[model samples]
Target: MHGCFWHRHPGCPKATTPATRPEWWQRKFDGNVERDRQQMDRLIAAGWRVGIVWECALGRKADGALIDRVEAFIRHGRDLRAEWP
Candidate 1:
């Protein structure tokens, strides 16, 4: 599971920048995004299926739909990449 802020989850409210040290935070976030991309690329090249479950998707409640989606992905997903909402 990846934190929306650290992983730079697009359109996520949790992905916010701190008021202080904006430049430093940007650099850190950029590096994190780049590293994640590189690792994902390597995994894909090695014929591994990749699935990313964002923190926002896991709410306080136990969502049946989310669990089902994850189960489906694990059991029968054939795509190169899959990400949760």
Candidate 2:
């Protein structure tokens, strides 16, 4: 299931962001990104699908439906790669 069960605490050391008192926003953010990468790596290695649901996507805006995006990713992720023009 692509590490889908490996949920972390959003901002914890393993997930949650550092509390205001710690004042380690940048470090925590970087760590979070890195951990996400590692999770992807492990998932890929295990031959599973990985779908990342960003926090901001939950709200209505330019991105639109979170479910739609996730569905599209799941349906097309394997055959997809970034293209820059």
Q: What is the C-alpha lDDT of each candidate?
A: 0.95, 0.51
Give the residue spans of candidate 2 off by over 4 A: 1-23, 60-65, 75-85
Best by lDDT: 1
Alpha-carbon shift of residue 68 in model 1 (angstroms) = 0.6
> What's the CA error at residue 11 for candidate 1, in Å?
0.9
What tens digits encode model 2's per-residue C-alpha lDDT throughout 3-85?
21234334323334445755567565566568877877787788777665544334356444555666677777673321110
> Residue pairs in steric clash, candidate 1?
none
**Whole-structure CA lDDT of model 2:** 0.51
